[model samples]
Target: MKLSDYAKSQGISYRTAWHWWKQGLLKGHQLPNGTIIIDVDSSNHIRETACIYVRVPSVEDQDDLDRQANRLTEIALAKGYGVKRVVKEVASGLNDHRKQLISLLKNADYTVLMIANKDHLTLFGSDYLIILLDQLGKKVEIIEDINNQSEDLVPEFMAALRIFSQKIYGKSMTKLQVSHLLSEFQKQFAPEEH
Candidate 1:
């Protein structure tokens, strides 16, 4: 259950729950959606330095990120990794804070770090992912491309767009024909910069 809910159920406030955690009495995993799960048994592995870091494209994308993060977490848990703390940040590949990301990058206690793409691994630079990969000592597995799978809705939307265009033209629409038309339409009517 969530940390807040667990705290409420146990008749303690959230701050008290945090205090218990800081003292190594409570253990929790921070889910991508900003909820924390606490397990008494998991607390037993509490170490002064173990942790994990997760980077996402945006905070607004949390709704879409839950499934991908869940898959990665499942694999990590199955491998018997003791994950203590987690870092979640809304950072884009093209424009992210190198200093802020690196502050978490040089962690020495984490055994695994699940990342979305080469962009994430290269948060610091090509040398950084290599350095951390070497330091962790365990092979870094590149999970499925979460970003690509995230665009699955695009095909469905394209089909719908084809159907709409057929109605607009009072004729049938071929996937190829509709795609070409859509491309032209998009180029002509692309959003204007403010």
Candidate 2:
């Protein structure tokens, strides 16, 4: 169906539909001949998934942070989360503080929360994660795996080992090694965290 037709069927204006497409809320595919096709199923998937938000630095160097935000948005969408509001570096990390991340942590509604790294944790550490986990207790599951693998298993395994290795060995491991070990000891770390 044409964009106008789809918009009419949904009782919304075509302009609104175009806005969603631009925001990545609605997806469109271009045909070989140059016409675009909108996948209603995928669009419906977007409607169903939970909102995934990103917080980044709003400095003159927003290019890199924008790319990072997009990467994380893709990961969250793949895991079946919707792309909701993006609270950019609206939160500052000055003087070892993260008011925005903390506010997000306090709210704790998202299915998953993806952060950059330890610097993020240093500003907002395990204590912050635990605080959200405790408040969200049983409402949602929290996973802290940061392995940028193409497969789900790798991320799951890495998350497990991240918790296990830290608990057992009290040491940090690289994402690549964690991904490898996760594949090696899949059964050993099948148990869910929290």
Q: What are the models' TM-scores?
A: 0.44, 0.39
lDDT of 1 by residue, 11-42 (tens): 44577566665665667677799777787564
List model 2 lDDT by residue over 56-170, tens digit each.
Answer: 3324335645665666555655654544433445222322455655566566345445544433333335566546554665122223335622332333334556657767767
* Stretch of 10 with least lDDT, candidate 2: 49-58
Candidate 1: segments with Cα more than 4 A from true spot: 1-52, 96-100, 123-128, 135-139, 146-194
The best candidate by TM-score is 1
- Candidate 2's TM-score: 0.39
